[model samples]
Target: MLTSIWQAVRRAVRPFAAAVVTALLGVVLLSGWLDAVDWPASGGWVRAHLPALAFFAVAFAFAVQGIGRVVRADRPARSRPVGLSWWVVVLAAAIVVVAVTGATEWLLAEADHATDRGAARVDAIKTGLGVGAGTAGIFALLLAVRRQIHQEHTAADTVLDATEKRVTELYTKAADQLGSGNAAVRLAGLYALARLADNHADQAETVLNVICAYLRMPHGRLSPEVSDRHESELQEAQVRLTAQRILGDRLQRFSQNPTWGGQVDLTGAHVAGIDLDFAGLSYARLDGATLIRASLQYADLSSASLVEADLSHAKLTRADLEDADLTDANLAHADLQGADLTDAKLTRADFTGARLPDGMEFRNGLVVRT
Candidate 1:
């Protein structure tokens, strides 16, 4: 196979090589013996005629080929064309070769006409294509680089678009699944939606509220220590607690539609952060309950039972604690600033840091007898 390929290449090369040698020999002879010919004069001639000769060569070739291509193209040309390929290089090179041949003959003739050219061979080599071709090449290179960069960036764009589409699909499917599914899937999906969704998306907050109400725990309260599957209700009773906060406690009591907390006795219930900020909880039995950090600021706790309750850090500022139970309650660090404590039982109650009506300060672990 190698021998056959070698034979085929040689046969093809023989005629082309013979033509090239003959052409070169002819040029050498025409210019006189190649070694004896003056190259310095030829170089000088080349430098002088380079610019004009190069321009004519490229302009003529482009005009002829570009027009012929447009006339013969099968497809109709659009207003803005796509781009061309490497074949442009081949065409331009061919044009340059032809022009160089013509210029060489012209140079020889001119040299013969002008007598004293002392050792100057009068060469008409037109090799330099000028800045026009260089600028075009640079532009083509920039376009090529831009195309490559665009191709690279396209993959990232596709991935991003696909990710966004997938997230949307997942959101839609989850919502659909939660609608007509079992309590477990529905609950799970609802919880998932709440976590993953944007703030207040697709009524997720409302859905959790609905589920909590359906279980009838006053709020969303599951049985204590149960794993959401055993028995019924929201796990930590936080559902009802959240509902009470979300749907106001006063509104629940006063609502035309009655709720569970309204009917049930909440006489000593430790409802902190329940927004009872300035509520009237008078005569309520709230003894020994953890009212720690409760916002009872400005609340009317007059005649209320607050015996031994952990009112530490409770906001009882300006609260009416007149005639209220105050026996041994940890009122340590409780803010009683502007509070009216005129006649309340204070047997062993820590009134530390609690302010009095007459600017009287609460001492270290002691309520001062006025």
Candidate 2:
């Protein structure tokens, strides 16, 4: 009998508890039938456990609502106790109601003292089904919601990845096209390079020469070497004293535009080093300025003024000093190899230990009065 009842229950539970449809209709139909026939009261246990049955039945419905979520949980292997949710209470109350209605019906049929218990028993069965089936429906809805969210997130990630890849390809194509063009393209490339040199101190400095080359000028622009309101030097001390301390820091100031007039005018300024390496100092001014141990190598100082300036130990290798003035200036131990001094005034300028004007002897590693 136990085995037979178990098989019946298995069949009943197999249909996703949807069999509750018939069970519900039968309960309502039978209750009305019993009322029409004027049956007396069934028993007392049914009325006593009514409130408890309702409480537990509602709890059971809520518990089943969590089933879908629990099933979809990432770690589903762990054991879940029954009473953790009120599902156990729901089941227990249902069982009690079912047993009470069964007993009362038997008494009504055999005792001849009360009416039939069919109505109340049907009601109990209907309540049990609602709690059970409703729980299952809620669980399924939760699972659906979870699945939808997962798919949405996955789609979003895929779109983001594709967008990044496409942007990279477009940028590569743009760079390649820029490389094959003429002077205008070259200027454009240089401008792009400067704009892209944001915050990269070493990299930006490295690209300065490339910018000058794109401009089709031999001398690099001095404006690219320094920025405005330089913060590294010129702090405290004397306005003119700590210039060297922050000179390198000034290399950050430069325009991103391609139209750069290569002219560095530092006329009458008391600077310590006249470093114009690869600078566009065309027709610039430095008259009467102090330039000790200055480095003007590879600079274009064409038609520039250096009249009466001190240029001791200054490296003038590969410099363009055409028509420049060195009148009454010092050129002691300075390197003038490969310099263009065409039509420049060098009258009364000291050439002691200088690299030019043959017959200058190097006596005991110093320029002596020979």
Candidate 3:
């Protein structure tokens, strides 16, 4: 708003400036022409009337300003109002006006022999006070607009901070629910975290890591304290399945939306009969884990750790296993057609009934059958 005002002021002052320059040039030429007939009388009369000329010039400028304000009032306001401090423009205009008034008074007083110098001083003082008042009004207007802008910023920041704090509290509560002994509570916690990850994309990777850590907890038959009986084992299995489903859904390779691509750490975790077909698990950690009959067809396992893990009857057709570790792992009857096993470890790994691609064998690590 202030910027627009300065622009308007500039437009108004331009015509006044042109008028002053033209008038000064005309007077100088008129004086030279009048010198041939009578330089003293005619030229002196015009020069003595400078006070009236200055008054008319100032009146013309004010009339132009009034016309501009009326036109602006009829126009609609802009959506985003650009503003700046335009007090400098106002001060410059006030200085020009005061200088013209003082110059006119000085010239007229010098021309008249009986002109009261005391009254001229009083009029000059009055003009200065009026200019100062106008300048102050312009400064106050700009200051008010600047204050409104600062208040809006403060309010927006306050709301954003409050929302962030609320989200953090909800995440903490859901994470605590995962540790409950009740299976329903654990299931609720899994769904809660899943919803959180879906709604708040910034926290998706952290939520995924938490779910992976929970699945990696000791859930083997040897740890009777963790999975004592059939009921406890069934509940844990359901929770684990839910966690795995959440992970699998976000690993789609052809999805258009932004998906999670962080490292999965199910290292030495028991995840038998888990279906992860076509899931992206590149560079993942599953060393010494149990994955008997797991569906991993066409999954990306490049540079992944699966050492000593059981993968009997698992599907691996067209899977990429470049530089993966499978030392002492079981792979009896697993499909390996079109799968890349280049630079993989297979020391003491079983592949009794596994289907290997043409010209590839799994005798003592992968090698050309010829």
Q: Best candidate per lDDT, number?
A: 3
**Residue 72, model 3, lDDT:** 80
TM-scores for all candidates: the values are 0.33, 0.31, 0.62
Q: Please state the error at residue 233 of candidate 1 in Å.
A: 10
Instruction: Estimate every model's Cα lDDT from 0 to 1.
Output: 0.58, 0.55, 0.75
Q: How do the residues 1-370 of candidate 3 rate in per-residue lDDT, one tens digit apiece?
A: 9999988996778567756765665575456542344423544876899899889999999999999788789578754435543544554455555444434444444444436866765665566566566666665777687678777877877897997898798789889989999888999988998888787888788888999899889974433356446787777778888888887777755556645667888887777767777778888898888787788878899999998888888888888888999888888888888888888877778887899877777565444565
Best by TM-score: 3
Residues 1-370 of candidate 2 have per-residue lDDT tens digits of 9999977886566353444644664585568543343223443555778999899999999898798577457555533222233443344444444444444444344434325456655554565456556655565676577667767877887996897676545445434534643534433444454444443343444344343232232221233245663342322112222222222222312324323343444555555564556655667666766677778777777788888777888888878878887777788888987777777776777878788633334354433333
lDDT of 2: 0.55
- For residue 250, model 2's alpha carbon misses the true position, in angstroms, by 9.4
Of the pair 1 and 3, which is ahead by lDDT?
A: 3
Stretch of 10 with least lDDT, candidate 1? 258-267
lDDT of 1 by residue, 73-180 (tens): 965765432455444554444444444544454455455656555333343222223333554566678668867766667777788689778766766765674554
Better of 2 and 3 by TM-score: 3
Q: In model 3, how large is the Cα lDDT of residue 315?
A: 85
